[model samples]
Structures are given as C-alpha cells and as structure tokens.
Target: MQNLFYALTFERTLDRYSQADTTEVDVTAKVDPAGRTAQLLSAFFGLDEGLPRIADWAVCDGAGGKDGMPVIFSHEVGLNTLEPGDFAIKRRSGKLGEVTCLTLAPADDPGELRTVLLAGQFGSESDPPVSVEITGDIISLDQSVTFKGAQVAVTPLEDGPSLVLAEKVPQGQWELGKAATGIPFGGGSGCPEGTAQVLRVTWEGGITKPDGNAADDQERKLYRVTIRQEDGSEETIAPMHLADTGDGDNNHKLCLDRTEPVKSIAFPAGGFTDPRGDLNPPTYIGVSQRLIDKQS
Candidate 1:
C-alpha cells in the first residue's frame, strides 16, 4: 500500500439573472490505500478519512477485458457547479506506464472567466507526460498542452490572422556570414561577422478559382535576418533555408547565426530564393535588438 497526499481548493461567484451565488472551498487530504482510484474518489468526496483503505476498483492495463479505461473520478467545477470537493484528474494511458503523481491548477482565461490546468507524470520521477491548459480560444494538446521534446505555439498576426509556431532548440548556425545591402546578394555593404538564425513560419493563402474551391497548392515562405551590434559593428551570415515543420501551413525553421551582441536589425525589401527554386517577393521584416539580445 502507498500513501496518497493531495490538496484541493475551489472558488466561484455568480451574479446574473437576479441570482447571486458564490462558493469558496479548500480541502486537503492524505489517504493510504492499495488503489489510486479509491484514494482519489475518497479525497474528492471527502469521504471517511480514517477508514481502512479498500481496493474495489480494478486498474486496467489496456489489455483484454478492460481496454477502455477512464479516470477513476473527475469533477467539473464551473460557475454553475461550484463546490469545495469538485476536482479534475488529467488522465493518460496506463499502457505508457505507472502514473506517479498529479496536480491541478486553475488557469487564466479572459473569455471563459474560468479555466483549469492539469499536469501529470508517468514512469520517470521528473519528466511531465501531460500538461493541461484552458485558453480563451480553445483547448487542445497541440495548442494547450506541453509535452516532452517539442512544443507548438500560436501567435496572432498584426493583420488579424493567426500564425502557429513550433518551439525548436536553435542548434548550429544555419546561415553564417554578414549583412548585405539588398536581397539577391546585391547592393548594401556586407557585414562579414554576422550570422543568421532560422524560424519556421506557416500560413495558408486562400486562392480560389471562380468555382470557390481552394487551389490545390499553397506554398510557404522563408526570411533571412541580419543584426547590428550595439558597438556599431554588424555581423552578416548567409541566408537560412528553412524546411517544412509538417503542420501544413507553410511551416519553416528559423535560425539565428551571429557573432556579437546585437543592437539593431535592418529591414530591407527584396526577393528571396524559395527552396522550390522560385523567387519570393520582397517585404520588410525587421528583427529587433531585443530579440538579438535574448540569444545571449
């Protein structure tokens, strides 16, 4: 038998339709039992604490006869359903391994006015297997959860569009060299010591024929960056060639290859050679010194 220790808290307020109801609750419990399900259920309902532990619920191993397994217990505590004992459990497949620990935290949401975050670990003592988050927009594993190795993020574009970016550890410098005067390697004096970083950017363009169906092909674009140091010295790196991150919307990798601390970045308009051997139109995308400084 193992010991199960948990702390839970609940808070909610409702003021609408001539009704005002509010609840604030906090509970902490420690249970020693043979099964996690019983312990969780007992803690959730605040059942007899000192009673002898019981292992009534069967734990499934995702094999024969007990394939579809659910969390032993789950509770949704929203404005309409607010109580001290309400709690939630972030579940994972036991097939992965034995679950070690779990925790739930309330997250911030401007639209929903209520949100919960759940985190859990499996197998190892430290690595997190599942991360839960509730956002104003939507809840999803790719968008709201953090897993090992890689993570994906969504950034709202200035033009009212949304761009999804995946987190990647910037490894070796993809583009090495200096800043140039213009796109196509023509014009502007080159900065010999500069390096360039790469970032994957994905976007979808809706180009439809008169029939209103999306064109079969929509391509992604890549941009190379150059930075100027605070000391007025500029380092130039070769342009990076980003590849698809596979999420579909024109995903590309972003890399920064630099030699010195950056103070400013030059935003010039010129065409870049697309990986497909096509020339991309020129636009001004500036890199801020703050972004460069973040590298150090």
Candidate 2:
C-alpha cells in the first residue's frame, strides 16, 4: 500500500464590484491515504460586513505506484477545458539516462479539455517520455538528444623502423648514431634484396648564414640518402635535420646504415641543441626527415 499527500488552493470573484474592491482568498489542503484518488472540498458563507464574499481553494496529491514507478494524474472538478503549460521528467536506465518533454493540445471546441498524461519506463530502450500543453497561445520545447554509434574500421600500415638520434653526444665533436637498425634483405627470412632505403634531411639551426649568405635566415635545409635492395625496389630511410634558432647550440648529426628503412620522422623547429654547459658556440643541431616507400 502506498500513501498519498495533497494540497490545493483556489481563488474566485463573486461579482465585478466585489472583485474590484477585494483581493482573492487563498486556500491549501493535503491528503494522506492508501488510494488511487483523493478529494478536496471547501465553502464560504456571508456573515458580518456584506461588502462582497468569495471562495478560493486548491488540492494537490503526492503518490506513487507499488513498483516505485512515477505517474502523473490530473483531475478537474469544474474545469472542462485547459490552456497551455510545460512539463518535463528525468529518468535513469542501465548505463544510460534521459529527460523527455511532451505537449498536449485541446481536441475540439465544445469537447471537454480532457487531461492528458503519459506513463512509461524511462531510458535507453526507447524515446524518453514527455508532455506539454498550450492555452490559446503557442508553445515550444527545447530538445537535445544523443546516442552512441558503432566503431568503424581502421587499416594497418606496414611497420618500418624509425631513426632517433641520441640525446647526449661527445662535447665538441658530432657523432652519427642510429635509433632503429636495419634487417638483412631477401632470403625469404628478412628484408627483400634490391629493397632500397632513402633518408631526406633538412638543416634547421647552427651557425646560420655562416657568412651572412642569401640563405642566412632561411633556417631550413633538405638532404636525401637512398639504399637499393637486391630485388631492385627501394625502402627510403628517415630524413634528419636541425631545428630553428633558440634551441641550444643546434650542432647535430644523424647517421643511417645501408639496411635500415625509414618509416616516419619529424624535426620540429628547435628540436635539437647543445647540452647545457659553459661552452660558447654550444654544440647542438636540429634537422627534419621523411622516408617514402618506393614501388619496384
């Protein structure tokens, strides 16, 4: 058994003169009982000072079903029609939740403005429940709904080794180093023969405009190295280069083997520079590179 509570208030004008001279009266009531419906009653009689008399009243009920489900039922005692009004509800579901809004309109003239109510399970299964109404004016609802979609496909690219330079190098001098070593070519076991590799290098920093040449401020230089496989096809090696100014000393060098195939590489502006020390010119460098697969 579920208990219900109700409160109500109403206002009425007995006459034009009385209404013009007096303020509307307010009334409220609450009902608690084990029932599907509740009732409210009130009355007013003339006593002393007969200027004008009026009666106002209202009754509201709070209740729920056995399953704890939520429902809304509206009853009109004397009103046969209704105008416009807004309504909304929030509900939760397994791993999902939603809010719904619905609108109700008067059927036809002469026909009683019947109360319209919606009841349903909320969340992911279907559209959320909603309700709405408008009197003689227009009404609208703002809605934003979203749902998850399926995952799409992603193709895999061939795995080619990349080349990363060592972080620290011997002070004053530059040393060439390799991050990813190359595999021997074709034998049905490793890299195919005639498979060539290429490395494209771009110089970024380090003694820019050595003599203040026209390319002094360019801040970028490009170079390429390629290795051919026994099969005649080629696998390009990653490119290398220097970064822009501001990256320490910017004097750096990159080394690649005849077997290593370049995959992907990038030399962001100012990527390399000399290690922190008191050295004047600062021993550091920046460079960029790219490797492409060549068709046989």
Candidate 3:
C-alpha cells in the first residue's frame, strides 16, 4: 500500500518533471481506528527540474521618473528569487548598467508574478540595450533549478509590441470555429472552407483601435503573415477573415488559405497598434515560436 501511494504521488508530479528532479515527501498516519484523525510524520522522496529562462522584457515607467523595466521568466520564480546584482545589461554603445531594485510589475495583477520589474540605467533610445545576462543563481519555484549565465538579446523598444507566444491550435480547440458564420471559416458547406490552417498568436500587450476600442476582424492584417511552402517557395498572405477567438484581448487566431504544406510563417512589425495608438515598429515570429518583447 505504501509503494502504491508513492507511485501515485510520482505520477501526479510527472507533468512538472525535468532533469535530475528531487522533492521532499511527507507522511501522515491515522490516529484513530475510524481514521477520523491524522498524525504527521517526516518522510523522503525525489524526481524533475527546469531552469528559469527569460521570456520577455520591456521598459516601463521607472521609480525616479525614469524607466522601470520588466523581465518575464518562462517558468514561475520563487518570491524571494530577486537580488540587486544578479543581472547585467549590455547596450548597443557597449555601456553596462546594474539593476538597483526589483519588484513584481504591480501588486494588482495577480497574473504578473512571472514578471520582475527593475529600476536601473539599462540603456537609452540613442543607445539601446543589446542583451541581458543572469550572472547570479536564480531559482525556479517548482523544480528549484538554478539559473545563471542565461543571456538573451534585448528587443529594440522602437519595435512595437512583439509576440509573447504562438502555437498551432489542436483540432476542436474552440467550438466557435466549428461552424463558419459571418467571419467564420466555413463556406457553403459550413465545413470551414474545406482546407484551412489556424495559427494562434499572443501579443505582449492588449491591442485596441486608435480610439482604444477593440479591433475589427479585418484588422488582423496588422501583423501580416508570410509563409514558405514545402516546394521551397514563399508567399506573403493575411489571415482569412474570421471571428476573433483570441484568449483575452492580446491573443488571436489567424486562419490561412490552404492548398500546399507550409514550411514556415513569419510577420514583420509596424502593422499593429496599441489602445493608446502606439505603432508597432518591427518584429518577426516564425513557426518555431520564437518569443518577442514589447515597449510600453
């Protein structure tokens, strides 16, 4: 029975497993014959791991009326994982700056925990930051993997909102697209035009019209897609007109006209606009799901 219980616990943790994982196991024993009460006992066990990686970084309003930037991690980090000297910044002019303080972007947004807002002189518009490095050990919340020397190039602030994530939607992911209506995928048969592919994209920030309203369906062309075909040919195309099935207001699905297999899909910047009417500069997202950042 003890072995079976241990096996169940291991299975439950399988999804979070990585390399050389270890965990502390606890045991509880029944105190009464009817098993109404329980007693705690110390125990042991182990298993997966993954290091924290930078997912996105952006410049925000600073504390001293300067810039307080946010660095988002791919994995959730421990609350106490921050330190002043853990990070190093490199700029286009080859100057360096040290982060003075760090905090969650804001306490209001519970979802912003993955982001660490920093205050320092990383770079300026004239001399943009080229990259960021993790010089000290950073630990993840789940597997507690240590992160160090993890460097990622900085996205130019002039390049408007970039992709936070993108992926191919699985079949039947959303019921909205099952039957084509006004902008739906279906044609006469309501079977979604017989041949269509869907690509889902999530931006770093919410997108809205110049008047700060939600964008129209046709506005998806803002981030135009260019795909390479299997036969070694490339064509630039916009997503087919479809109802917005984006997650929250920052994500959206792009329907593609289909005939041949596609090798890749990428988009240049400057097409998208923020609710505040900020224009996107340039950023590219491909089939491999390379993450991009934003400047707010």
Candidate 4:
C-alpha cells in the first residue's frame, strides 16, 4: 500500500547557560489499534507545553490516509517522561487494516533524510530492468519533469560528504529569470517565448571528506543516467563528482536546464555502485513534471 511518515522538528534546552540545541524526530511507522494513543511528548518534550520547546510537527500522508483525515491520535495519561511506561498509540481516523505498516527510526538531523514513496510498490531487489521510449528533456516554468520514486536508499550523514546540486546561468540568461526584468531570479511573471526552464536530476551518494571523517561510513556512489526520447534517440547524462568548491554559488556547469521536453527517462541495469565497488539492481524514482514550481 502507501507509507506515511512524520517529521518532528524541535529545540531542546539542555542547561541554563548552554545554548538551546535543535533536533528532529521522524515517526515513519504507524501505530496499531484503531483508537490507540500515539504519545509524542516523551521523545520531544521532557515537561509540559509551558516550557514551549516544539518548533513544528509535520505529517506526510502516505498511501492509506489520502481519503480520510490524516492519521490522528490522542494522548492518554500525563506526559511526564520520568515515570516509566510505553507511549500509548491508537489510529484515530483512517483505515485500520494497513494503518500500521511502516517501521520508523529516530533521526537527529532531518536534512539528510530524503524519502520517496515507491509508486505502485514496483521496485524489488530482484526485478529486471525495463526500457522505455522518451522524446526530449524539456524544462518550463509552468510544467517540468521531476523525480518521484524510491526512498533514498543511501542514508545521509554530516561527515559523509556528498556532491551538492549546482545550476549554470549563462550571461544574459537567468536560471529562474522573469521575461520582463531580464534578471536571473525567481518570482517573475511570464516566460520568454523561445527559452525554457532547465531542470536537472543528479544522483547524490555518500563520500568521505578530506579530513578523514566519514560520519555514517557509507561510501559514495556513482551512476550515469540515460534519457530516451520519443524520436528513438538516446542521450547519456555524464556522472560528475561532488563539486570541488563551486556548488551553486558559482555557475559551475549546467547538468539539466529548461531546454527540451523529455518523454521518458530510464536507468540501466547494474548502474549504481559505491566506492568500495558494490552495485545495486536497476531502480528509478518518480520524476516530477514540475519540480521547480516555486522556490518558496
């Protein structure tokens, strides 16, 4: 079915003089029982709301909660964590059968976690690759191609350095410019007749930093993508390493821009590999038609 996850971003006050530190907790799994209680205060708060520690809590509705109100729960008993007891959990308003499907874990920093729900539950560790025909890769302000597929199989770590995404803006050309001002910034109305928006898809994997510190110890991976157009033409997007210094600040190189429209994109079998020389089966995430709808 579908998988739902919750992202809880909050700040915790450790001591009087020390600075308040921020952390995130991911409730990826669903609680059991139709009317069970899902106590969240323990992991996030040590006391009551008067302390006011929570920043924001977001619920990402997955497969089962689309029709009904997003999976809701109630709190039972006091929220004091000093007392010993498991947090009571109950599924309030949703389908009870598959409500508790996902298994979750605690995340300190949520920036590194990039999750994509596998559409139609298609990809398996053992499925053969499929070839599809695509026309041309086109990017536009209104509608564009984007990715939506599997969860980021690679875990993110602060020490595990990875290449950042960069955009290229030529002189007299803006990355997200408006038609009137001729400036390369967002929030412009109307696009030029000839030019299109450029949308690039890059694979981010784990890598070791020069300082000999790899946080998660997950090695970096490299994979080349192949674009299949409707006209039966094939083009390959070269794989680049993490930019040395210039990421997005300096217009290093344009990987994908609003140039042409693409029919279908595909990844070859046995394309993914890590630094240690391990490979993964062919799998693809969903590419959105409007990835750059709005920066805000």
Estimate every model's Cα lDDT from 0 to 1: 0.23, 0.20, 0.44, 0.22
Which segments of model 4 are wrong by more than 4 Å? 1-254, 263-277
Ranking by TM-score: 3, 4, 1, 2
Sorted by lDDT, highest first, which candidate order results?
Answer: 3, 1, 4, 2
How well is each residue in 53-144 modelled by candidate 2, as lDDT tens digits?
Answer: 11111101110110011111111111212111211223222231211211111110111112221111222224322221121111111011
Residue 265 of model 1 has an lDDT of 24
Least well predicted 10-residue stretch by lDDT in candidate 1: 40-49
Worst lDDT 10-window in candidate 4: 103-112
lDDT of 3 by residue, 186-209 (tens): 111111444366565545544445
**Candidate 2 TM-score over all chains jointly:** 0.15
List model 4 lDDT by residue over 1-296, tens digit each. Answer: 11111112222221011011111222222232332223221111011111111111111123222111011011111111111111111122221111111111011011111211110111112331111111111111112211111011112111121222322223233333232221111112222233433323323332122332321112113333345566878665532221111111111112242344443333434333322223333434333332132332
C-alpha TM-score for every candidate: 0.24, 0.15, 0.45, 0.25
Candidate no. 3 TM-score? 0.45
Query: Mind giving the per-residue lDDT tens digits that candidate 1 earns over 219-286?
Result: 22223344567777666543333332221112233434543433222212222222122222333333
lDDT accuracy of residue 202 in candidate 4: 28
Which residue runs of candidate 3 sit more than 4 Å off their true CA positions? 1-64, 68-85, 91-120, 125-128, 139-147, 161-165, 169-214, 223-263, 274-278, 289-296
Judged by whole-model lDDT over C-alpha atoms, candidate 4 comes out at: 0.22
